[model samples]
Target: MTRALSHGDPLEGLPSRARIAELILSSRPPLDTYVGWQHYRTHCGLLVPAPTISPRQWSMLPESRQYDYDLYRELTNANLPLQDTPMHDKVGKLIRRRLSSNTRKKDDPTRAGVMISGWGNYGKTASVCSAGAVFEEQWLALHRCLNPAALPGARDLHAPVVYVSTPVTATPKSLCASILGFFRAPTRKSATLPELVRLVADSLHDHGVKALILDDISRLRMHRADDQDVLDLMRAFMSLDVTLILTGVNIPGIGLLREAMWNKTTRQWELPPLESTRIHGLEITQTEHRFDLIEIDRFRYVTPKQIGVFVDHLTGIEQHLRLLNAKVGMLTGGTMPEYLMRRTGGVIGLLGRLLEDGAHEAIGGKELIDESLLDEIVLRRDGPEQAPDEPVIPTDPPSAAKPPQQTKSTRPRNTTFDDHGPASATGR
Candidate 1:
């Protein structure tokens, strides 16, 4: 269950310094793997509720009061859900199906292989990592429950999910070695490529791995010999009926997998760029798609609701605050939306950092975050501002005469690095 710290606690109303320190000291990281999931909902962090507190109630408390700081600390540290769109949910569903017990023959055109391609930071890694983590945990739990004898002297026990990222200097031998290392296979200084591949395939078979995720596959600098070796290894896995998922910012051309006839068998999905921007209660088209038409003199951004959720996660103040309202009110007209969006380019990774930094600044003082501190933080990262009169999106109530068009940017990308994919099969 997603635990919510109680705001109704009578002690919360008290101003105990010790109470504040204890809560801060008690803040610890969530259990990584080895965690028990009652169902899929409890397994993934995406479904966890965002921690919320009343901003109005928070500001009324003096900073000297432990309660205020305690709230501030928890709000700042809260693991807010990265709002998953319908598309992300669909992709996750596809991966889940791949992990099913059903198997396809090598010649079966419906082989379970997929490629998630998108711009950097769009949440590609999150979806795969979450799915892989949950599936692996559930599989381990099931294994021990059903095969108790297997646990006592289980030499055949192996992880079901293997995640690896392409190294900067990726080669077939090094890549195989990385996979073998994950299974704790003894390293032979002069092991041949075929030997390493055999070790990987045998270990995966022994452990009963059902899925593999190769994230950042674009980083593989394939030489002629390395290319052939990779193809051979992939073919071997395909022969074993292992499901493969590849994620990358810029996927290699279909030709890289030509020997394996990958394009004929693999499914591909992409995160397109933003299509429209919401400004001054009006939705304006930025492009038919990110690649189509000319660039317009309009702001490129996320919807009010999308950004609003993040703001609420940061402040825990009021869930009702719009992006502009929070900016002007909390920062006291410190920064403008145009500058903020342009600097971060509406990337969630950068936006999250900005809000977190601002929270830290506010937590350092008696008052809520002000313009000066926020400006300092922005200036240090984004440098001096540009376009002084960059039109601010007015938060004025929209006219009911005609409702504005609401179009969401469907194109997304992964912006942060997390340990995931087919290279490492470390069971938590």
Candidate 2:
């Protein structure tokens, strides 16, 4: 009898090329339903780091082997491990604490949520999703990987996390529909707003969802009636005993917090007076008061400590690189770090893209990275305009050695006088 291949089984030979290709295709998680979320959680937890091969060994490999190796390297480079940064640490700690506290309070009418606010590419969504994944892992372990509320014979999925991005033009009905869609729940076009809300709430309870992440939340503008309704819908979700996480670019600057004032003493945002009849009956204050807002900013390279931290981050990226001719201190060394800082403006997303593109170029050509190679690459900025404060690299500090003496021009002097004398003789 032949044994069935397990996920851990090694892929090798000509046949392994097809296998690796399949794995690459399936690497991206659907991330909409419970099953999809499970796939993502498992993928995140079970990433197998690609093996490194020396240049000499690579050169000796057969053509087929070289193709397989290159394919695998491409896969690994695209999904390099998430590095530990100050922002990640801060967000992770806050999320863990909030989830723990929410889980303990079984009778609280409303659970506090967390808002991860920052410029795009500052890793707001990544940080929140990672934290959610970690929380789900621990939650499952505590429950022994079984849904405590699930029936013995039911086919319900035990999803501890539900992630959904707000629609580009979000409405209350649409937002609720988005959540229900994650659970693959049936939704009739004729269903009322209240019906959709109930469906979403019931689905969350039925699936044992502990955390709900609403990404790109700033898409909802407060000025619009539909968006206002969407905000109210979010408030309703808070009461369903789930830790709601909202992530967006410049959340405060966006209209999400319009007319909301910050109270330093309470360390919470206070909603405006309930003068508008539209929100008079709804609980508008709880969301602002309960949700803890956290900001993630790009790396700063001004101070000595700041420079050290930035270099440390680059070192982390260097360690994960699989380039054949990559050298020590390739990214973190002397002027190279400054060059990268200028190129990316210390935005982690831009930095990662620049490095990833450079790596591909390196693999195809010299198998090494340098300032000149990176200079040829350009990155697209999709986020809000970079702030003025985070300007281009500062002028270099003055050197102690005297500057080289200026040299006199070697060209002939201006020819206006010489031409004028010749012109006069010709005119006469």
Candidate 3:
């Protein structure tokens, strides 16, 4: 007789064929597969730190197990913890205030936007993305994990933050398409500029998008007609009640601020005479008045306070390292801190890259970070053309100071007397 499955049955927990098929069909793609709703949602979720293995335990493992552990450590090194630098704190505060204020002003015709400008490799994208992720997390929790605007019995993804990179060759239509792509909203190939804009606006509303982030804003040259239209299109998005955040490298140097002058008294950017500029029939006044421009620069190492803060940042990174031979103050103690500062030019992104490469090299053999190991790792920023704004090497910090090398004396008098004996011996 056939027996019924019991709670203790080995096969009882196995999924049926139908359940397996459903999972295969419904499972979300990995974040690397696409930069859409699924990816952004996953990114906003919690990230568990990699498992920690003590040096003693690692030493006890078999050869194969050691190889696996090393592989995992390499991956972990690549993604070091995101430190809460001064830039991140400022950006987070500004974004949080702007998003919270915007939510209360639902009936306002337009919302003021934020623009983050800085040098390349200065962590502009990371700062903005982290702030956006935090905002999305709080927004979802506030809405009870449901889209407030969704219709009853309808399934709609709640995307509080929409991030899209400005295309290298952006136009009004192409920019709209980029925004729509984030939501995975369908758009016909033959769709006109106006149609695409309407679709993007609808998607923003339908998905309950609270903030829209457009990175690489410097790519839009105001000198180009297409870029001008794109700028106007962004202004139009501001009217849709979503806070528009634009980040880029050297935004002020770009023509974006050409028509706007900085007012010292008001401490804000203001537009010139309205008659001075008009783009695509839209006054530049709207953009100047509606967008608050802020900057996030690379770390400075001049002042005592600055030096202390820089060392503190290194301390934070050192805490997250999983190296078997990592010791306290590996990065912050001795001459290493000054060495890293000079190597990275106090740029957070470059510092992270340098440490990442150094960690990989350490894991491969030494299992510890030191100046000798870091010297072997080359960085892209080391090029002459891409040299940092500050001097690469500093004269302070006695430990980092290098003594001049001794060279052989060029005077022939000393050699003349010393070689006479050798010449006489040879002649004899």
Question: Pick by lDDT: which candidate is best?
Answer: 2
Please give, for residues 70-172, the per-residue lDDT of candidate 2 as tens digits: 8877776776678788888899999999999998897789999999987767888778888888999999999998888786787688888999989898988
TM-score of model 2 relative to the true fold? 0.80
lDDT of 1 by residue, 113-171 (tens): 66665445556777677777766767668776342323455676455666666555667
Return the TM-score for candidate 1, rounded to 2 decimals: 0.55
The residue-level lDDT of candidate 3 at 185 comes to 78
Q: Alpha carbon lDDT of residue 363, candidate 2?
A: 82
CA lDDT of each prediction against the hidden true structure? 0.50, 0.78, 0.75
* Number of clashing pairs per prediction, in order: 17, 0, 0
Q: Could you give candidate 3's per-residue lDDT for residues 1-428 as a string of tens digits?
A: 01222334323233444543453355454222125544655554333333455566666667756665565556557767778888788888998899999988957899999999877687888788888888887888998988888878877677888888898999998898888877677889999988998898888898898899898999998889999999989999998979999998756556686644445466454545455445345455566688878877667777888888898999887877668778788998898877887787788988998998888888857878999999999887733432333432312223666889999988766454454434565676
TM-score rank order: 2, 3, 1
CA displacement after TM-score superposition, residue 395 of candidate 1 (Å):
35
TM-score of each: 0.55, 0.80, 0.76
Model 3, C-alpha of 76: deviation from truth (Å): 1.5
